[model samples]
Target: MLRPAFLAMLLAGISPHVLAQPATETVPLLREIKNWVTGCDNLRNCHALSSPSGVDEEDYSSLTLHIFHQAGPEGYLRLRFDHRGEDLDLSTLLLDGQPLGQALTRDLHVELDDEGGDPEMHFYSVIEDAPARRWLQRLRNGQRLQLPGDDNAKVSLSGLSASLLLMDAVQGRVDNVTALARPGKAAASEVPARQPTPVLRKFPTAPALTAQEQAGLAAAAIKALTNTDTEMKPDAEAGALSADQAMMVVRTDCAAYNCEYEISSRERKPPYTETLLSIQPLPLDGAAFEGSVGYDETTGTLSYFYKLRGIGDCGAGGVWVFDGKAFQLREFKMMPRCTGSPYGDWPALWTTLPAP
Candidate 1:
């Protein structure tokens, strides 16, 4: 188990080296540079993304750039452009006011644009060998990179070098020739191997409860929620119980937009020994509960979705799978700022391996 202070540092995206922990045991990290936010998962796959709103821009722009670097000696680097405007002529793309030239060719870049009206277009390209080295040289010292013409947007390159340097450091690529920010003659073979991902195997599903068992469990949950001594009638809408009647998950309160729920497990029969199940607490508040939660019997998974706003653009969420005894974290993701991005776009702070 991670110490409280260490976990807090990881949650805040502080580099593990700041805490003097071994590199092999480094937790995932997320750090914000001047104009970019960078993060790396346990597997050492690093991602750096520029904000839609640049350092000097007041309004959010429609174009963004994303750079990805995989770990290990043979890992690859990729660059992607997401544009929410009209079709772009690749020939007009600019890197610090100069034409991108043939460095960005259609044969090397794949366009995945939507077909609808005012569709969002994505230009994705994998960079390796000579082109990767040359582009890295240009980008590390460049000022601004943009796509020219109407609906113009620029990603500030101010903090890009520092961001890439951090990525190289995290993956042990400091002086390696493959380093994005600080390349040297050191052989790529010296780079560390990618770490294996953690895995959590879900327990077998519990047997379904009978109608009577469900009703009894529901009543008990309501009584506990209301803090009443005697058994109380269950509200049809809020009555939710696990398949085996061993867990009760239901909403207890709500405000203008957010609703709070409680999760508790108990003994199967009378004089039930019920104990509330608490998920990992959020850094914002000391609370260890979720806004909305549910249980899927077939998969033995309990999931939660908490919305920071009514529109549900930003917030924290996670999934915990039952292991026949207790719940274990499977994944957790959060997007602290709202940028009109979907939940799927959020950076994952925690992740586990797939069941074989």
Candidate 2:
């Protein structure tokens, strides 16, 4: 028999499990003509998104579509329309000249004119099951989408073929999934083989702030408290301020997590104003103002960090970078678990911040 030390060494050399750890890969954003966009996540899921040009003369009028694909060769589609001043009652979806019978109304929120005098309406629909597949086919081959409104108002849809093609290529590249089925033909079956999972890379920790940076943050925090746009209304019931009173003074102190500020009126009255801004000591959803906020000189970015309540060690926050005139929010990410797209948590996941 082998010696005890030799046996211990042999056991130490071998791993207990045969499976390797999952690895994550960063997939860059893909853009195509007419502003179509597609991307994939570490889990190999892919999505295609686009906003079609509006029929209305107003520049703000728009309609957006998003398609998502999972590994089971399954997928779904979402369509949204923003009608700020007009009432929209979309009852049907027509591809070319054929009406998709499977279409179902998902949601409708109408703001009456009498309530606020400013009417706003929104329409949303989620297409899945057979209807989603049928819509995909029609988009690949059809030339027009007809939405018959009152008095025979016709809305035109174009550029769908090119958009779907880009999405198909992206899904195929990332998930090895495809939805391009020929007319009157069934889609091919997906293989049962599993794709290799990727390991997730960690983001580097931000460095400590300098004295000058701390001062700057304190100043910004004070200004943020006094700005008219900021919500600084005092609660009379809480005895913080009288009903007619307003904030007349603001002071701030900077810490690693955030800058705490105090607001008061000229009288130095009772129930003084005390609040937290910029950052919070812990990560919690919907508590943006309570997160840790700081400036990173290396990246010229204002970063905020907060805890993602249910997700351990996975942080959620946003980053704002300074433009020529003012700071603008560029990116926000919430990673609950490390398996899916980093930017897939919300609609319009990535935005272009305007310069002040």
Candidate 3:
């Protein structure tokens, strides 16, 4: 007596529970396990990171261990826990059933402790020390970590040997440096000597410019300042003038890149005429020129100093010599600005051309 379409709609609205079956528990998919990973920084500092295996998504989000080595033969380890909405108070650490006496807690939210807010916790220990060396030995032999509230639960320390190897490689230490420490003895002193820092190479100076060559270089400087593409020669008819007889002035507009300059010259003769000899653009690959060009008439050494704007005390400069036919780049140096301290002025760490 019912319409076919209506009957079909009624059946579709029925719940399967009407014919009940036994309830089944939901099972979570297993996550890919990453035991430990190693990496290095631009300055060659090395780090090793790891997390516990078999940890669910919720539990793995808040826990990790990190080992770091700076530009030295020493290393350090850190255990991090994100306690954003949970309570965590670490008082002890254990490596392979042996307690780490030197483990200290660093709470980033110490100021917020009195305000009843959760704070992230970091437990740190230096591996170069005696206690840390013992821990490292245990990790190498049988990797395991046990925290205060873990109820004797220990996580396997996989990839620890490889991680230590990576740290040693960064420090330029040999395989012997990875030997485990003896019980009740200090092994920090057993670390191999750190490699010495390499020396910076210096550029050689060029021969002094001749009278005619000086005139050509001066003309080129004038052309560079005027942003012109004119070809200039060191011929006698190009108005050869001595350094004392001709004055050159260089100026920049402080552009980050593609900056141009104006070179004005004044001849101390007869009418004492001033002329814009050349208009040339700055080298497209170079930084902005900071101050005026320096010319040592006695040595015929012309220096061009360039600097990056907004970077404190960092600059690159070059010395050039005239070879009667053209100007030759004799020496070039680039200086890096010091950082992270009140005293920011440091000498140039490198003098070679930067890698492209």
Q: Find the candidate with the highest lDDT and give its number.
A: 1
lDDT of 2 by residue, 189-259 (tens): 44222244432222223343435433443344354454334333311111112232222223233334333
List, residue by residue over 221-324, the lDDT tens digit for candidate 1. 66677533323332322222344347677566555565556577765566555755544443322234455677776676777766666777566677877766
TM-score of each: 0.79, 0.39, 0.32
What's the C-alpha lDDT at position 85 in model 2? 31
How much does candidate 3 score in TM-score? 0.32
Q: What is candidate 3's lDDT per residue for 256-335, written digit by digit as tens?
A: 43233443444534343565333222221333333335555444445665443343233445555433323345444332
Model 2 lDDT on a 0 to 1 scale: 0.37
TM-score of candidate 1 against the unseen true structure: 0.79
Q: What local distance difference test score does each model get?
A: 0.63, 0.37, 0.38
